[model samples]
Target: MAGLTAAAPVGQPQMLTVVLEGLRSHKGQILVCVTRSADHFPDCTKDPDKRHFAVPVKNGPIPLGTVAPGDYAIAIVHDENGNGKLDTFMGIPREGVGFSRNPVLRFGAPSFGSASFSVAGAPVEQAIRLKYFL
Candidate 1:
């Protein structure tokens, strides 16, 4: 499968179209994390309820499986090495990274409010442009 969906849904099943842009290379995998928790806005490894999607580099619209209609924030990492984690050097990302709203890049990932978007019963689209800072 391309994504990890919620086990038991809360509301209607909805689809989220995540459009990744500015990919430097199509070598490895695309690791995505979706969460509504402010504390887990970017790195959601601690967010137990977070949704994960691992899609191949070549794509049209990433299939993030099914999700409940609600508010969510997304963080993406182009794992060009397929290391399963965002490889960073001196706290700076060595790979490409992006957020749902294409928030400005700073010392760290944007706050939840900056990258968050609403997922209504209808399908929603998120166009995120990747950034590389090596």
Candidate 2:
């Protein structure tokens, strides 16, 4: 006996869902950036092709969905003033910021290689804790 089989399409794009933790307050939006290049790791504004998303900062984690499959590094900035940019005081960020792998903070943001993770064909989740400098 032969029967029809329902199989998922081959080579479907994967998704990377990021959940941000330790938000200071629910005042503004959360700026999220995902980059596949080391040259444009933390700053998505510098690269016009990089993927960026923004959502309100609630008490819990914020989820981002439907991301393409690939090796990528993520950056998040809690824009407390909804200024569409990370406010800085003397070259240091005043808002809460985070990275995908929660790399050690030495001088500056982590390199793409240090934070990068691969998304094959399944949904991946990353939980990042926000860090505030001020």
Candidate 3:
């Protein structure tokens, strides 16, 4: 009798998917920034280097998908007034914004390293809570 070998399970390439929720209203553009580099910090600030996608939201879970496997950080800002910009007051954001992992925001936005995570060999899911200020 010949011994039979078991076949290994096929691995799927990793993908990062973000589900944006708790949107009060979609008055402006939502910008999603994904990056592999965190050395310079605030990678979203750089014009050409950052991989950014802007989508219009009308209050629901917006799924951002097809992200390749790697170290990455995400930043989302709700340009609530449709000015194509984040409104801030007294060094604090007046409009809705979000970050990966949804770290507790304090005096300033969390560092890229704090929000960075590794994605490999499978799909990853993240639920971001939207923040709003009156």
Q: Candidate 2, residues 1-134: lDDT per residue as tens digits?
A: 37955433335665567777888888989999988888888997777668887887775545666656578889999999999999999978899999998888667888898888877656678888889999
Task: Check candidate 2 and list the clashing pairs.
Answer: none
Note the residue pairs that clash in candidate 3: none
- lDDT assessment of candidate 2: 0.81
Query: Which one wins on TM-score?
Result: 1
Model 3 CA deviation exceeding 4 Å by range: 1-13, 40-43, 47-49, 58-65
Q: Which model is ahead, 1 or 2, in terms of TM-score?
A: 1
Tens digits of lDDT, candidate 1, 7-54: 434467678788888999999999999998999878888899998768
Give all TM-scores, in the order shown.
0.87, 0.85, 0.77
Clashes of each: 0, 0, 0
**Judged by lDDT, which candidate is best?**
1
> Relative to the unseen true structure, what is the C-alpha lDDT of residue 56 in candidate 2, on a scale of 0 to 100?
79
Error of 1 at 89 (Å): 1.3
lDDT of 3 by residue, 18-131 (tens): 778878775778877777777634446674556677788755455566555577788888777877777788877888888888888877778887888777655677777878
